[model samples]
Target: MLEGVFMSFGAIAASYFTLAGGGGSSQYANAVLADNPLAFYQFDETSGTTMADSSGNGNDGIYSAGVTVGSYAITTGPGRSAGFSNDIGGTTDYRATVPYGSWMNTNELTVAFTCFLEPMGYFRLLASRYGEPGTDWSWFVYGASGTLRFHWRSSGGTNTNIDTGFTPVRGTKYYVAAYVNASESGIRVYDATGLVGQATGAGGTVNSSSRPLTLMNAATGNYTANGHLDDVVVLGSALSTARLDTLAGIALTPQPKWINRTAGVSARNGTTSHAVSFIPTSAGSLLVAVISTPAASSAVTAGWTKRVAAHGTYTECAVYTRSASAGDATIQLSVSISNVPLHYTVYEFPVGSSWHSSVSVMDDNVYPVLTGLPGSSPVTVFACVSDRRLLADTAGESVAWRYFWRTELSQETLYGGGTDGIFTGIGVIDEVYDTAVDVDAMDSHVETNGSGSPNRVVFAINVA
Candidate 1:
């Protein structure tokens, strides 16, 4: 009997947690993806003027020749950020232009950038638009004043200014942003610290831009900033100071997927402790292993705690769990006997998930009756169990399994299956769920058949 909150019957993770394109770890992309931006430019290019939009929205951008950039190189920020130097020769000949499709003509729009500047001693435009004289909006740190400003020209030819009192300095990296919405105030400007300035007169948005939206200059060469920019994103809706902070200092690193596609989510078998091979990327990640050894008692590794231990067909089955550390490449454990076949499935719980409870079945129960859950919020319950040999549902809690997937391996042979059995085997059955269903829709237990041989390893994870 352990002291804990909720109860769980499973754990799962794989491509389900995959971040943006493979070029960067989803660690950072995941956060950015949460906001659902229309176009996200990581500036991960070397020679070509093409700026790949990582948002998957296909709103790619083209850079000007004056801007010299390279593949991702900077790493001192959020994730992996490409580094580049802007040399827009004091002219209106350099800028990054992105398509302003009909979807962009929104009343609510936000544009943000994280950049490091080299003293330019002149006007520097961060982002803006170029069109008819009466229809233009631009934000820049004006020369001399060095104040961050947000301005917009409404389609009605009305001009408004939102002077974000905060000033940016040369030789310093800063996260700068501007928000404009006709439904709200004038315009809001922000720095990494927070909302520095806003007003109530700017009532225009992307609708005023005739050409593509431009960065580092007003789509022309005017006031082009000389610096490195990253985390450049454009949103379809306006965001408050709290929500807009998410874009600050976001980094992007192109690396191999945390877990590859081929063999990360399935089951593996071995005769030794060092059975599974996985390289976790950070701390606080939950690593779980469910081991079933044929007629042998398996032991948990040094750093892992056994969550549930049960027996079936004289076979030892247990669930081992451990949080991630700095370096946990290949997990190792041992059993009483070396020659016995040990079948196990290793799963990395979704990132940022908290464990609830885990249970293994010795009788007819596959999961526990979840009640008295402590939180007002909902949690994810995941489960997997080999039911090749499940005892009869004489326990009354027995119900049909509704959310499980069949596996290819035959790990549990019911005792009544006419083999080296202690009870009557039921049939060859494997079940698990990789995705989520309504939490209340889960059953308390499962039934094979009355008087049927029941023996298997089952486990679940509840994450809040």
Candidate 2:
């Protein structure tokens, strides 16, 4: 591939389950429940306030007046399912509570739910057992931002969060789940499309044993869900990726992740060079690079293959990649050049992944977008502009996306006696992405440097 190679490119309620229509309950016979969830509440009740636990463990939930028991909504499951509609501020705020018990397992845990999100501009509580900051467990969608936030800690603040790169909306019905396996140090998350995100995990937490499992809204009354909740589940142990995929009702091949990235400092043709360094991100990770230059030079390190490039009139950009052997070995990038090869950056993609698709050009792009993305892979864009006083940023940024480095090249006066800049980044978009929903727009800079309208070479890469 010459010009383009790579390129390019929740929440929920408490824990409840509804199998469309009257007979929908049978769907729970799925392998998900085989893991023996601590308490499984199948909300089949269209009357009274009781949401029964069918896991043979009997931990039931009661509803508040604000909850309409027999409401309806369509789901990824069969039939038109029965749901619980929280009248945002109708009478009382929506609330559901299941008695707390020894079910709290801080070592490994899982929580799953299906909900209809509304466009309210507040916090929509999903499941909460939060009391104090250090030991609290809060999972919900910030109604204002629609970001699915998860907080799982061991004690004090020694924990972190897992982010599902995609955001949810009102029109779609989604099945969401979070699995925390402290032993594996993995927190896998699923939405309508199987395992969408995963992070180094956090252990579960043993509650005060006094707080009831809050569904839809927190006990402190600080936050409440503003939509409909159809199915929710809690497991004492983390569910495997296959089981979690089954729960989401979607078949997705978990894609590779963007592990690490490195960029060198500014250099003039005869003056400077950078020795960029990065260790193998994983046992079998692959390292790749995009070199932008005015012309070909012997500036590249050995053992790297040029995967793709766009040779423009004034400048050009190329992609180079190499396999990383399993282990803690570090790869080095040393360079020597004459006029241009303006900059180069190295990156590591998840093990067993390869170049999928991309888009690139050796010219100025005021409005650039990366399309033809592989459904479940991550994409990263890199750009090098002639003007050094540059600012690199994403046109459509989000929680799932990450920026690696934005370096300013102050010494170069190549091609146009101009300063230069470069910015490159990626996303854990390795989720089963709905390309129709996610945008891959790339921009060179927010504003031009005071001295130039320089040309630039921009490219996007996808790894699967």
Candidate 3:
């Protein structure tokens, strides 16, 4: 048994435990979650007419016009999402209205959210403050081409519009943020990879209005959104591009005493390679964990190997690597096995941090366990790759996996599925990443088929 206070995973189905110490908080929680915004709606309630404000502000929202709580993609984590499907000519519409507050009466402001657009034939409003053309502000999709559009009226009765120029595809989730200041305004659109489209303009000052904030539709119930939305945030001041990118789940800026995780998966056959890059703001050691499916017919003799030339001085485990590099590091895995799947994760740790890793072969119940290092704040990341032989026998296998990552100040649990033996399922199945606050120990259980066939499991514990 590990010594220290144990934190529960809570609502996360994954079985994992952490030992607490030093009481250091997370950098991300401090930067993003603790920024003291005017209002923030996680949209995670199971059943409620009122959407609670997570920013500790008293600006609660009321559901209206048939807005329903629904499930979103795993990318938004385990939570309920707001669902909206507007009828072009019919009265069927939905929205959430938050009463007017001081935060809504600022010239310098920012609005951001994660939205899944279905793209109907007519114009659809994703969010707005009022319906008046020359006096209101709104973010919407162009009916003709589905381009993301932002419109805000200035104090002088002049209306400014910004376009992303890139049309949103139906049934895809996008992270969008729009801001307006006295001199300039802009809109940024991001997908899983990174920034996709952006537009900026100068000479526009936002005007204050008496209208309440409306989400997923116009205040007049016109042009309603036809999809899902979550993680709505409203700030009184404009945020930097780096901070916005971090909130959009792209990348986090590395700082002293900070931890960040980056992960991805590939199933290309015949001696292929997959790589991800990260630049540390300061010099430090990094903990890297990788899991790959074994050879199709036999156990993996020589598994994935990290390129020392590309990464740096590294210590390799069965499927994990610990690298000590300065400046920039590129985590590359060269796979020689044919027709197999590969998954890799690279975790960047700031100075004064250390990490340890462990690996296990899968059984009916697989637990990738790592003993905690003294004086290290521990956060655990686990990745499990299903055996290729088990997939060859089953035509359409749906594998369910759950994993959790927590920093001292916050924790996030995500669940996903994949087909066959390929860990290409939703969310973080093939690639797992997470960071935790002052933790002393780490362990987790991953349940798979009872068939004696073995899968590859990798675990890493980072102390800062």
Candidate 4:
């Protein structure tokens, strides 16, 4: 029987569940939540003259002229996107502007979004801040060439122009990111396959002006956008290449349901068990569980299980387990090994919108039964735990692990770092694997440490 179980909880008024130790506040978590953006427009509203800022930054955009919200061109999960068309009668058409603030004064900034452009003869602005002609910052695409561009200039005439050399195809969806730092800036353009073009420019300071940020058109309405725009995000800092790549890879649809949780176990000399319990406020949520075991513990021997209630039967899910050697032993619903710490993760789907019981073991390898709801529906919620024993020779050594879950289509796009016994505690490092996709196909690479030391890692996802 399992013994010495501990439970802790961190509550947020929001509907989504978050991990302990303030996991929701991390930068990586912020990216996943798409929270705290200087300005973020999901364009998910059905009808409204005002474009709500989902970032909670209060920098809302007010629609003007005949700008309308329409169905998203690619993914309907996000519902709708802001539409823009040129009006020859001198009307401004569709555009939005956020009031000016100090947060807009950063020397570094990142502008990212998904867009589908229609063919046109002139330049079209995606987003911009207008100042007197010689002093402006804008991100736009050349309508004829489809080249992504970022132009910034100071009143003194010092300026920079960064552009992607490759042209995007008209009428196709594309992800674009522009990064601007004090003396340099760059642009990354991505399509369905992967990265298309990247270019950087050096020189000139990133000028800050009092102009309000505008979307889909310039302040004067000269360069109007002729396309569909969705999932727009504007950040105060210039993000790294890897983060940009991550933003480009994931599905742009905002997840309707999700949660995250984590647990840690200290090393013990003999067989000991630890478990984390997560009770979803919503019934029938899908659950994705991940467990990381540090090398300090003795090899796990498949002695773990999850139960919906204290005495409920265990449910099945797709389980993938790995061990250091081929000689590891196996147990029912678990794996057994000696002298090698291990990691385990599971993806459990809901049954017709209903949740079931679950159980887990701390072994080197796992072959969990793959049974649950299909991927067509969104996951409602999930819980996870890590249980293990310390090596007799490695008693008192620390053993730690963490896991999290998100709805389908909410998978993480990028992950870095390898399994080399480097165990950074939750939220300490920027690299995190919180998405279900990380476990489904083992999409991210994991490197093993040859030493008998512990190799552990926690994976969590941030939901918006």
Best by TM-score: 3
Residue-wise C-alpha lDDT for candidate 2, range 135-231, written one tens digit per residue:
4453333334555656555544455555554456543455566656645434344443344455454454422334567766666555665555555
TM-score of each: 0.44, 0.44, 0.50, 0.46
171: Cα error in model 4, Å = 3.3
lDDT of 4 by residue, 1-464 (tens): 11111111000111111101111122323554553567776654434666667677777776664543432122322221121211111135556767777777676778887765555445666677863464455333333355677776643456677767666655345677887776668888876557788889873445777777777667766676555555668887788878787766663322222232223322222322433333433334344444444333222234333322110111111222221122322222221222222333333223232332233332323212223422222222332322222222222322221121122211111111221111211111112222222232321122222123222222222222
The residue-by-residue lDDT of candidate 3 on 7-90, one tens digit each, is 121121111111010111233223445667888766544346777776777789876634434221123121112211111222
**Candidate 2 TM-score versus the reference:** 0.44
Local distance difference test scores for all models? 0.47, 0.47, 0.47, 0.42
Model 3 local distance difference test score:
0.47
Q: Which ten residues in a row have the lowest lDDT in candidate 3?
A: 13-22
Candidate 1 per-residue lDDT, tens place, 360-381, comes to: 4564533333343333233323
Error of 2 at 287 (Å): 57
Rank list by TM-score: 3, 4, 1, 2
Residue 437 of candidate 1: its Cα lDDT? Answer: 32
lDDT of 3 at 446: 31
lDDT of 4 at 62: 69
